[model samples]
Target: MGKQMTEMLKGTLEGIVLAILSVRPAYGYEITARLREQGFADIAEGTVYALLVRIERNGLVGVEKVPSEKGPPRKVYSLNVPGREYLEEFWTTWGFLADRLGQLKEEGK
Candidate 1:
């Protein structure tokens, strides 16, 4: 990703992750992998981990430690009620921005 896209992703990464969890519960690596599958190829695992920590601290996600065959227990995250509510708000805000930005882009052209 270019610097501008990277910067933009930073702003939206939290919502993106929450949106991912809204689909299903997943561990950190799985979340990162899903992001890659969705075209966020440049997102670092460490970035996702850090964001996970933040959201977990904020009580936006409910986590469970499940045994991992490869290493220590994995912390699988699920979107709780609060998380879902936040995700809904995120989508609303995103829609508002998208509409405005779309208008601006057309105006510029």
Candidate 2:
């Protein structure tokens, strides 16, 4: 990815991960795979885990330990009420920024 994309992701990854959890509960590996499938090819697993830790610490998500066939147990995360609220705010903020940036791009064109 380009430097600009990388920089943008640094600010947006948390919201992106929250949006994913809002859709459904998933474990760390599942979240990473989903991000990759969604075109976040440059995202690292460590980055996602770190973001998960932060959100969990912030009380945005609830974690449950579920038995995994391939492992001892897997920690699955689901979006709590606070997480849903946060995601709504994220979308609103993202929309405003995107609209202003779009205007800038059009002006440049």
Candidate 3:
């Protein structure tokens, strides 16, 4: 991907990660898989982990260790109360921004 593509996607990356976690609790790898399946293959794997740590630090999310049926323990992540609230705010703002951008494009055309 080019610089512009990265720049365009940057704003929504955190929200996308949070939105996925909202559906269910997930470990890091599981989150990566979900992102790939959702067509975010261009996202750097390290970036996801970094975001996870940041969100956790920000008190927006919580992590719990669950015994894995197969291998080692897994740290499962879920949205905390603050996370849900933030997501709701993000959704509202994103909707408004997207609509405004669409209107601007239409007018430009």
Note each model's CA RMSD in angstroms: 0.9, 1.0, 1.5
Which model scores highest in lDDT?
A: 1
Cα lDDT tens digits, model 3, 1-109, are 6788789777688898899889988988789888888777777888888999999999989999999988888889999999999999989989999999999999998
Total backbone clashes of candidate 2, pairs 3 or more residues apart or in separate chains: 0
Clashing pairs in 2: none
What lDDT is reached at residue 42 by model 1? 90
Per-candidate TM-score against the hidden true structure: 0.95, 0.95, 0.90
TM-score attained by model 1: 0.95
Question: On residues 16-64, what C-alpha lDDT tens digit does candidate 1 reach at each position?
Answer: 9999899989999999999999999999999999999999999999999
TM value for model 2: 0.95
Each model's lDDT: 0.93, 0.92, 0.88
Off by over 4 Å in 3: 69-72
Better of 1 and 3 by lDDT: 1
Runs of candidate 1 with Cα error greater than 4 angstroms are none
- Predicted structure 3: clash tally: 0
Q: Give lDDT tens digits, candidate 2, residues 11-53.
A: 6999999998998999898999999999889888998899889
Going through the candidates in order, what is the number of backbone clashes in each? 0, 0, 0
